[model samples]
Target: MRELLTALLSQDPTIEVVGSATDPYQARQMIKQLLPDVITLDIEMPRMDGLSFLEKIMTLRPMPVVMVSSLTQQGAEATLNALELGAVDFFPKPKLDMKRGIEKRADELIHKIKTAAQAKVKTLEREQDTPLALNPLSNIKFSTTEKIIAIGASTGGVEALRVVIKNLPANSPAVLVTQHMPEKFTKTFAERLNKISAVSISEAKHGERVLPGHVYIAPGGKHLKLHRSGANYLCQLTDEEAVSGHKPSVDVLFRSTSEAAGKNAIGVILTGMGKDGAAGMLELREVGAKTFGQDEASCVVYGMPKAAYDIGAVEHQVSLNKITEAMLNACGAAKDRHIRV
Candidate 1:
């Protein structure tokens, strides 16, 4: 696996394979000697597990590191923990015909590694418990029509989405999320959010009614779009080919929101590696949906939002913490609360 990754990455003109290590001790020695810009770490390493080593690195060196793990329940949980412990991103270790699998996903691997290299990593502290439920909005009046919130994220989304979604009020609009993630990981991500957020969150199922105070995460390997069904909007999932190089694409969700909900939709583009949602966000703006982007300083990787901002798709460029309030304001639910923008 190590040899394959080295060979694959070395093929990229912009990337170079530095020293490779067989163990944590060797890795530490190589890090000191080579001082490489980015590190691709395996979750199951000899001498020390990746999570423990990752925590130590974040505490001491605080550099960009990406996790390479299997795609399973345990792997998903450990990857999430690694993110919280300061991993910039994670890539699933190839399964079945190792060399071919690696070759097939070589572009994705290279992209993630490059993105990780550019990510601004802050020291991660254990998160404090947040209130599980919010006070019901008293002063806000809901229109007869439903308001929809469309949120897109990638690289640092696990933590960034946590900050934004957990801050939403109990009466917030129905949210449709397209976070770049793998199949099983999306379910686990939604479950994690449901525990910490005021609103209910689940992986979206085809033909399900999009309800208020709930978030629908686009299932991995599928496209999540919205359809108007009488008085309610419905979730529609498709196995269309990858859009913007993503299956559960942010562009697909935002485009559907613009067409279906129009002015009633709120589009948010958060931290990510590339410009997947930028064009779709512009379409949303053209259709009168309010759009917001996370500012560069607050993002782990500022690529996506910066693209949106540059293209005029984003109306407001706010910090990560202020995104929920901005969405609530767009939904007309942020009247009395003092929200910092």
Candidate 2:
């Protein structure tokens, strides 16, 4: 398995196969020696379970970790927990059937590893404790919105948002996104979104106003909140204390929207790990706002949305294929509300 994976990564110039191990004991020693930039882990290592060893690594010498696993339901749940414990993400391993499915999945595996390798490593250090710096918000400026849409996500959020946003109309409502990304990546993510979707998307500048036809991503290392002044909404980027174990926490964004936009805001929680946005989505619902969560069948990791659903945070559950239509329906300018939300 290690040799095959090594050859696979070597085939792609963007990926460098640094080290590989099938057992936790060998993996631990390899990590100590190679200190590779990114580590790919299998859930069922021979010497010890992957999760137990992963806990040790996280509590000891934290670094970027990605879990490679089967796509089974059990594997999915385990992989999601690993993310909550600070593994950056997970990619479903290629199926074992010799004549089936593997060819179609190899590119996805390669892409995920490349993305993980490029993930900001330093952010893992005290990442859960990092606060939102309020400095950027001082004396900032913003554009007002007729109605603001607040969205929060993590883990597989990038691709999920891509699927949903790609289907939205140019006249869609103003959007504020809080995806749990690192500092440099949010800009890249926003730029990527901007290119793939008709709506303008950019990294949030402190005090930037919420405007229809544009989307703002909360800076990865900061916290974003909505503040209202005379019927307009402003994005206030800050370094205040971490909320729900994430710097740009989804809960913080949702709660602030509940406070600032009230009934005019639509809160959506997409794919991710942990219980971060569960409470906030409910708060959005309580204020006569609409709340939506990504359904389990379509999630890369169903942790966040499931947490919200279990606690009554979501008023609607939609699959990846239908979420953008749902968002459009919620926005009221679209021709239909027939889509799920």
Candidate 3:
């Protein structure tokens, strides 16, 4: 194990394997002695389970952590819990054949580690500064017409989506999301999102009726389209080829919503990598939809929104803190909350 880890470090000039251990006791001692930039943990380590050790480490000395997990039910659950507990990400495989998994995915693991090492990890306890107003819409009168809100994101989207969706009123029009993530993670993510928000959120189902006051999440590994059904718009999820290098591409969602929902749809492109949603956002703009992008200052990485802005797809640029209110304004609420004049 140490040999493989050493090889991985040597291959990457930027990474230095400070220290590693075969058990949680040794791991703790190594951490105390080395204080490495990042830790790649094996979930099945001896002495103490990786998840429990991770919980302890995060509670005692919060730092960037990435877990190596198997593609089994237990591994997935553990990884999800670790993520919720402040671990940045997990690399998964179905086998314990270390040579094949480690060598074949060394580059990917290297990238993940580099990103994790630079991440600003905030423990759950440190995030309680501003409580989200549980009923922010108590005093505002919303419009009667049905509306649909379309949101696009990638990279650091999970946490961002939570902040925006949990604040949306139960009466807010149908919301659709296109976030760049793998197939497995999206289901878990949707389930997690549903638990925190007042509005109902679910993974998008093919041929499902998209109703007002419900949020439809685009399933990962597929494209989601919106079609008009008499005065209503319904969702259609498909296993189509990847568009813009992503199956559930933001451009695909934005374009479909533009053709079907037109002026009734609101398009928002949040923090992400690459230029996936730029052209589609322009299409939405041509069809008279309000479009927004998270400003560079608040973005973990500013690639996606920057591309959209460069192509004139985004009409307004706001920080992560202001997006939920902006969506409400796009829905014809009193414009004083999420948007600035």
TM-score, candidate 3, is 0.81
TM-score of each: 0.93, 0.60, 0.81
Give the whole-model CA lDDT for all candidates, comma-separated. 0.88, 0.74, 0.80
**Model 3: colliding residue pairs:** 325-338
Estimate the lDDT of model 3. 0.80
Candidate 1 least-lDDT 10 residues: 132-141
For model 1, which pairs clash? none
Error of 1 at 318 (Å): 0.3
lDDT value, residue 221 of candidate 1: 93
In model 2, pairs of residues that clash are 132-238, 132-239, 132-240, 133-238, 133-239, 134-239, 142-209, 143-209
Model with the higher TM-score, candidate 2 or 3: 3
- Among all windows of 10 consecutive residues in model 3, the one with the lowest summed lDDT is 123-132
Off by over 4 Å in 1: 133-145, 334-341
Q: Give the poorly placed runs of model 2, Cα more than 4 Å off.
A: 1-145, 334-341
Please report, as a residue range, the 10-residue window in candidate 2 with the lowest summed lDDT.
129-138
Alpha-carbon error at 316 in model 1, in Å? 0.4
